[model samples]
Target: MNLNPDQVSNYVTKYADVLVDYSLKLVSAFIILFVGIYAIRLINRIITKVMVQRNLDPTLTKFLSDILIWALRILLFVTFISKLGIETSSFVAILGAMGLAVGLSLQGSLSNFAGGMLIIVFKPFKVGDTIEAQGVIATVSEIQIFVTKMITGNNQTVFVPNGSLSNGTIINYSMQGERKADLTFSISYDSDIKKAKEVLLEVLTKNPKVLKKPAPEVFVKNLTAASIDFAVRPWATNANYGSVVSDTLENCKVALDEAGISIQPYTIQK
Candidate 1:
């Protein structure tokens, strides 16, 4: 059917107005998005630099920056959608539902993520630190968002979940920059205790790896029916811990053997 002139003119005006308004809104949203991206990067860099200046751990700093950037970008996207004249209340509801679904499915990962964050914030341990946790003794190689990598004494690589690590007891052997190598030596009952102690002290002091500040300790620990036990401990830098322990033990045995202080096997009957 043919339309009336006035009716067509009014319809054309309304359609043109609607198109122009939507076009402007779309353009505005695009501009906001581009600007928002640049702003997010700028903000992330500024925060990361500040954290670096404060000597925050690099892993934590990077994780924080990425999280903050993601959250900001999500908000920016939401704002852009709102500009398109879509109902945000429904959008928010949809997001909440999706979030609930994701959270339910990823509870364990979320717990680990939170655990990792707590570890970073509390400074419980850092990269290159040796920590004992979860029945494993290893040196930390890297700290990630959900897991920590460790290198064992035998050159094994282990990945530990952050959730249990943060919740469990952690023995940090490298925190003090120095470690004590506790070595025990057994001597025959016939051996003179004074000679044994002197031999051990000499052995410890001669090792260049052992620290001289704390001084090496050598004393009669306990007397067994078969032998006398001497407790010997030497302080060494963490970097020298393994080598020092091995050297001290081997040297003590040789010194005792040469000094005629016999080391005999001792047994305790229960």
Candidate 2:
């Protein structure tokens, strides 16, 4: 069947109109999408700058800014799809399902992240502070988003998960201005307690690093199976802890030996 020329022209014109309508809709959608994304990014940058000016923690500032930007961009995308006559309820539902699945898989990591946030906000221990936490003793090197980095006395770096750090007991040695050096020495029972105390006091007095405010304590602590234990508790600066400890031990031994007191060693019978 041969078609008339006028009929063919009318069909072409109708098809062109449909194509132009669709093209306009697509162009509108793309423009809105690009503008929305740019706005979100601009808002994120402004928020980050404001936070930085307010002296907020860098990690928290970045995290919150990124979250805000993503939330806004997602909202804009949903609105753009709705403008294009697409149903968004199903899309939102799918996103919710995917988010739940991902969250469940990352529960532990999320917990750790939350713990780290708590630690930062509460200011339990800052970097460079010596702390004993989670059965590990070390100086805090860095406090990250999910873990706390520590440098041990032996110069080894250790990373403690924030979840465990937040839940466990944290002993911050650097919090206090001074720390006590608890040193115990064993002497023969025959040794004179009064004379021993005097010698120990002399050792502490000779040491310039020992703090004078809290007087050094020297007393008989206990009577063990082999000898009598004497406790010497002295206050010292944190930086001089090891040095003072080593010096105290060496000087105490010398002082005791000079006073004719002998260290009682436990004897094992074969």
Tens-digit lDDT string for candidate 1 (1-270): 989999999999999999999999999999999999999999988999999999888988888888998899889999999999998999999999999999999999999998899898897889999989999999999999899999998999999999999999999988999988777788988889998899899988989999999998999888878778888899999999889987987788789899998897533211
Scored by CA lDDT, what does every candidate get?
Answer: 0.89, 0.86
lDDT of 2: 0.86
Ten contiguous residues minimizing lDDT sum, candidate 2: 261-270
Model 2 segments more than 4 A misplaced: 1-88, 265-270
lDDT of 1 at 237: 98
Over the stretch 83-162, how does candidate 2's per-residue lDDT look in tens digits?
77789999999999999999999999888998998888887887788998888899998888889999998999999999
**Candidate 1: pairs in clash:** none
TM-score of 2: 0.73
